[model samples]
Target: MNKSLIEKPAGCSSSILSRCRAAMLIGVSAILGSSSSDAAMNVGQNLDGITYYSSGSVFANSFKACGAWLTSPVAGGAWDTGFGDKGPSTDAAFVMRTDGYPTVVPFTAGGVSQYVHTLAPVYENGTHRLYFTGKGTVKYSGPGVAATTRVLTGGTVTFDVTVTGTNDLAAYNATGPSLRKGPSSWYIDILVSNSTDPVRDIRIMRPGYNTSGRDTFDSDFKTKLGFYHTFRVMDWLRTNNSPYTKFANTNGKDGTGIGKDFYSQGTGRGVSVDHICDLANETAKNIWICVPHAFTNAGMNDMAASFASKIGVGRKVHVEYSNEVWNGMFQQATWVAANVSGANTPQKYGTKAAEVFTAFKTKFDAAGKGSQLNRTLAGQAANSWILDNSLITAGSLTDSIAIAPYFGKVFTSLPSPLPTMDQLATDTYTIMPSVRSWLDSHKTLALSKGKVLLCYEGGQHYVGTGGSENNEALTDLLVDFNRDWRMKNLYRYTYMGDVNSRGVQLFTAFTLSSQWGKWGSWGSMEWLKQPIGPNSYEAGKEWGIRDWKTNNP
Candidate 1:
């Protein structure tokens, strides 16, 4: 008994019937074609002689069709953080039939699901293309009677940039650079020596009463601390011949340039964000810029979209959503990590931290916009044990990890009333094992998804206490350690910590000698000078003994 498959639609034209039979013989693999008004379709005839037609459309709704996914519930319906007006902000998706019938759908502004009815079919090159409209779509193969086995490999793919040449190494060891060994790394004694010219100044004197909480704007210090100084340091680095490991404002969850009162109020945490962009434009150089903030709420997507539009999509700018949401201290410090400092914040991390994370991922993966996201997750640890599995394992979400640990002594010259350097090294070493253990556990859980780890911001504290000898030893250890691991990216604590001399009891001798006198000095008074660590002058720019030897006292 030989086998002969047949397909017959009652009352159909002979030509249609003939085409149907041929299609059946070709099996379920669609040989879909379009002839202007007449669309040709292929159907597989089963043992019962019943045939099925491929019907559907492809649309650009879901971020190239890789938007939100249906997993658990949140708030009400499937937790949908909803992307900005521009669909999925990250990845892309498509479906295909072995017979050449194709349908492709992309995300629409971070939607949980796209509109289905409006999908369109694309016909070209003897092939008919189908795509999803709004809602997420699934691809199924085989005869319609009983579809068997789930096909899991039919989506876009991307790869990380492999570090090549000595460029990365050279940059890693540039002047005043920080170092890392395995998981533990910190800033060292590198110096940025400026010409004998006055360091820089912004003198504002108001004759009227100071309604903003102080009399003389001079005495009321603000510039002596925070990322403002960080910006200055970065600015100086750019002008100099240093390699650029860029920095930017990523805190956009709530509003613009890190909310209004970020340092105190939960507003504008990443105020210096604009500074990064401005710096890039002014220099016209392609440097690694990062937005330090969490994308917990929809705010990240909006900010990302805005920045992408300005910077042009798929450029060198890197935007990290939420700085460190995994840390236990998220409520108070979430903005610091996420970088969302704007007016009338869209949402907060009440019970929505995980939801925000999920939404952030969905948006990032929905559109091909992921190319614009060099998302990083930053965290602080007292020791190596701080980087356990729980910190990173979150599906295919995170891109990079920035570990900020004040491992060495509190200050380079003074000793803290705390633990010793040996203990510090021991604790720092423990972090690598903990990170490894955590990564191993999460790798198993996620099958090794997400970005490999990197330390973004970790430094030896130099504010209050810590033995000078310990600081020196730690510095040497960091140099040796960084050489060993060849850490990806490293940023020290900060540029200026001379704010301690503001009030009476707390004084510091460290002030940038200015033309009009120390800009940070008060009322023409030379305050009790407390020498900050070796690099405190220009924040490690001139700290290298090479420069010191050449310059002398």
Candidate 2:
């Protein structure tokens, strides 16, 4: 529910406020030494420490009980997001075949035929819920076609869209299109071109995490990644077929086992470590767990002792505390950014992040837990063979580093308009060297202790127009990215997981292709089929890709 509106009580004139302040000095929560119109207690002012702002006030009689005012903050608490695609009110685009010439006559809002330019169009989603309307049509090139005879009735067409951000023309396809969830957060995609031509080949994908301000299904997805649940999925895989290694959390706690709680009972809002152990004990295979954040020290120690006492400690379950703390790749940035004054305040977050991690580590060691007690830190600040003076002086902290060489293009060119998908990819490879230099400088720091450096997350983006026949480059790019970066301890951002298409490119493709079906296959047995790409029919010879891969590949 939205927070209640706050307003100053009526009869709160200057004299009355002074008296109220005097009487409530000790009764009030704040003990500040200020009392004026601009003071925090005044009307339309943020009361709590939270940063909320009030809209312009409507002058009302101060003599009345009170004047209600609205206070809406950018983000004050849990976000209540909307669901489902908003369908357009217009009819579907009409397919016309006249005089032996076939053409697509776009529907217009007004009942009239308008002329328009011709361009070859191919779409990803088969279920065209949205349609474009345009007046006039170019003459067909067929031999028997008559000039100036071709006409298209312009009107509305059914399109599913939720307008967000400045780019209103953009819409979310089940395929990859950067999108956000909530009241009206615009989609976040690297603009390829500001060209007048309508964009095609632009692929939208959902994000694993919405650090880029894109909406995401992470809260739901996190449930699947639970230490125990992921193990079940992995076990199902290995027992039935493939041989993949299991991943462990940073604390070195095995997928299955008990861990003591240093503080209160393990009641924090996180997937339970014991749950993973229970699954593993049930004979699950290929279980992996990577707890993104370090548990409080007391909790960590308790978990370690509990785990060791039950199953005995080993390397099967691994844990790394300080991994990629400084990189823009991980969600750690979100926690750091939250405490920061603004996105531009690098020093604010940078120093605070180190302090938080340091406290976390001290508690872990003091509690006495885990087989590998030493924390592994990654993404530390470095310059050549020495630590960066700025980070060192600024109090950057971590034991090891996890570097993710995520070098890609934000755009073909930024000063002017954007570029197309093809142009975006070309620009990525061209800008790769700057990324290499950054990595090399850090690698020089390896001159000292063999600090752990793991590639925690890595992948390349695919931007292209057209269908399977024309967009082969996308598949090839994915194959190459996997081949190059598939190293030990590496975890890809996605493994075909998403209920909605927002920031992730692959899942969006599946969504846009009508792969989920008319009702969205969300709760039905068919929902499992949503992950299959458009080529599922040809590749799986079955409706569901998961089933197809399970049975065939």
Candidate 3:
């Protein structure tokens, strides 16, 4: 839902409900429509399942234990350490520290002085060779450096490194590599013949890394069986802010262009479709893919065919046109608003979504896998009219209507001296009735149209907007609120409790793990390494959802 539509009233009691009602009314007035019948409420519907919305893939991201990168190094540039003024470096190279580094170094002389391109290999400890194709010199610095240098002669070159215990970046940086921790600044420099473009097809051939062709995912990632039911790859594919119109090549070179190497810079085009399919096949998890809005009919057909052929047997595919086309905050919404022709934004989105669904359905049906596809039409949870208009226009093409039924938007705009943790909890609990009412209306509409109800994203949405996020006091309050034990109760009891009883078939939590800051505390846990369990104070939203699944199952 658009943030501009929600208003923060002075009082906590009325503020939350009024904001929800205001958004609901705005949606109702946007389009004129009515449902003929309401589906009978299922009193105690067993939760179909609970899944996670994954955090995006980036060099600094710590969500996956095996790490997002295979062997490709972090791109060289001025490092944004979130403070200020980190020094410069050569292209395709990384610096360990600006204080100890030299500037204006030649590419032939190892790019930058005292700089070693860092990589996060698998957690397993042993001798492993980091492989890459091209003529280059591999040099290692910091701890775990077994063989310092290996010369490359336009062929695969392997550098050996021995890791001890679990690779924790904080410990590695603080006290070197230990049995329980690894350094974040473990550096390996690869100076290739081509200065502009470094090495190609870099592979970290470690024990838990992609050493075997069968199991490519990290050991820690694969061990989390609860999160494997479905993996939404919106962030993995870099769907937002993407400009891809065609499929990424599986064998393309790194740094050439968009959609090339799977390990290209995080800001570049997304990973290949082959990698996404491989992840699903290896993990045996259903994949929810968001088609890029810029894709043409041919591109859509190609993507569908690729998934139909490559996706493992019996694993389902949840297909959404794009991530929130109705929310004007994203580029896709803006693109549709300008490019797509319709009576309104919902109709235009519906028209394009129908076309996308048709393309995927045709290919999947042709491949004899139509039953494995879940065609989802997403809309704002607060707005029934968006779904009403879109679903009506989409007709039989959509199999499910998806929405994000999050609570706590009232806190986003609340002024300084924000509500206390107890007050926020009260407001959260008070708003449950309204959220349930909204769900009841949408569930009925979905059933009336013969479509299932699914949640693409949902959880505590207590982030500030405009310049409110910059308020240090507000940021501190929100962070503390997330860490508080009461927040867990609200998630397990009020939020998930409501959705489960309301008969939402699938409720995917907003995200897996992320660092909490001014932007938003979207992650269930602060990071993958954070302690998680019923007794652990560090456990927050992740524990709540996990505990719910255990009891419900």
Candidate 4:
């Protein structure tokens, strides 16, 4: 189900690769060419267009800014990810006991038992309740020194929270310890047991990052602005009979007909335009919303109308259908195959896409808002074949086409001895020419029909497929080897998107935040929960944010 960029079997291993060296390179799809360089810190051998160098600085040549794909918030004070919170004490999820010298022992602050640290911890879906019975006061403290203490009542108290970005815990910065401190960038809840007697103040709180000397590794906790999703257990959800939802608050029944939030009552499975607007409250900017093709016509209308009413007029609302429908990993792809007639055929996919778009557009038109010409982007597969039966089917309904300019395949179909990360980076570059040619031809085709091209998904896929190529050790080694130039090529692709200024209209990167993996660096924010510090691949996250900010379309 993982997007198969290469045709290698999932079970193929390095041993098999070694034995079939010559067979590996046969008939691979490539039409590489050398590209002229404009970067200031060039460091690679340009052989037929791909740069073989293993290291270099990110392109400072005025990066092409685009919108970051916001999917989930990643903020945890843990060392490992992918397992959620099952690691050692470095776990993002933690439990604190205020009895007898801190039995849980979450942190070691100058020999004193500190209870908080910066973490992109999980606050599962729902309310974090507090039950108070006996009389007792709870105190919250710690950052650098742990001096401040906020008090609250015991019996029963509630706090609403959601995942956002956590600020970096720099040992150099000051504002309290700064360690373990998760500002408004995070959503937390406090739960206590119900007691008959007046219970003391049991506060659920967080501390800043530890700046002192321990600023080297990940502190207990930290955070930034509100992101999308963060992995957390749902234990935070409380049953208080109040039944009031946090963000939407459209609990139980509402006279307004519309739910408090977008997905609260929508026919689709993901967030809606109003949901993005809700996010707008945190981001305070126009947003790009990817609507699922599965949405009912009614849901699409509500989403469209919601965008018009909430986002205000003239605000940019970049919209697209289900992401990568060509890839069967997602339900949309499978749904199309089983539902849409003839969509199973490669030639009929575009037709199915166009049909999907037209159906959504119909609802949008009924809403009497949103410029399909300027806003709606017809999503396409990342594959080279741009022309599809759907293009003709949509006809005038399609004005802009969206494609993912993703390249940099590492583990797919490599030569026998296996190339180094440097070679992988170089090989990725060789792919640009073919993509450029495709884009150029597509531009002519689009412009002929008064349409434009855009990149709905953009990032690096330079990872191995299954078998030994899927070995975690190899993955780590490559991550270390290509850390520098890998990013360079990533930015390189962004620049490629602007080929002759007729390339991509909006380059929406694959995501805004994620954990370690091929797609880890793809986010504007690293799955900050893992990795030691900024020295890790997460540095690319900053570069992503910078690039997005540069060309703020």
Candidate with top lDDT is 3
lDDT of each: 0.24, 0.24, 0.54, 0.34
RMSD of 1: 33.0
Per-residue accuracy of model 4 over 465-511 as CA lDDT, tens digit each? 54444455555555454355444433433333243144444445444
TM-score of each model, paired residue for residue: 0.30, 0.32, 0.72, 0.52
Q: Which digits, one per residue and each the tens of the lDDT, describe model 2 over residues 1-553?
A: 0000011111121111111000000010011111222111100000000000101000010001111111111223212111100111112232212110113222221333321222111112212121223333323211121222223344422223222132111232335322211111111111111112221111111222112121112232232122111121211111111111122222222121212221101111222344344434433322222323333444444444443333323323333332233434334444545644533324443354354445444544454433333233334322222233213423335444433222222111122333433343233333233433444455545334444333232222222222221233343332232222221001111111111011111110111111111111111111111222223112121123233113221
Instruction: Quote model 2's TM-score.
Output: 0.32
Better of 1 and 3 by TM-score: 3
Q: Tens digits of per-residue lDDT for model 1 on 1-553?
A: 1111111111111110011100001001011110111211110000000011101001111111111122211223533233221112212321211111112223233344331111111111111112211212233111111222221222321111111121111122333324211111110110111222211110111112212221112221222221111112111111111111122224222233332212111112222233334433433422233333333344544544444444433434433333333443333343433543322122222222334345444554565555654443333332222233333332234554433322222222443444443343333332343433432332233223444443233222212212332354444443333222111111111111101111111111111211011000110111111121233222232122112212221
Number of the top TM-score candidate? 3
All candidates: CA RMSD (Å)? 33.0, 27.1, 9.7, 14.7
Clashing pairs in 3: 168-182, 172-182, 172-183
Candidate 4 has its poorest 10 consecutive residues by lDDT at 45-54
Off by over 4 Å in 4: 1-273, 281-284, 342-368, 372-387, 413-418, 428-433, 489-502, 518-521, 528-538, 544-553
Against the correct fold, how does model 4 do in TM-score? 0.52
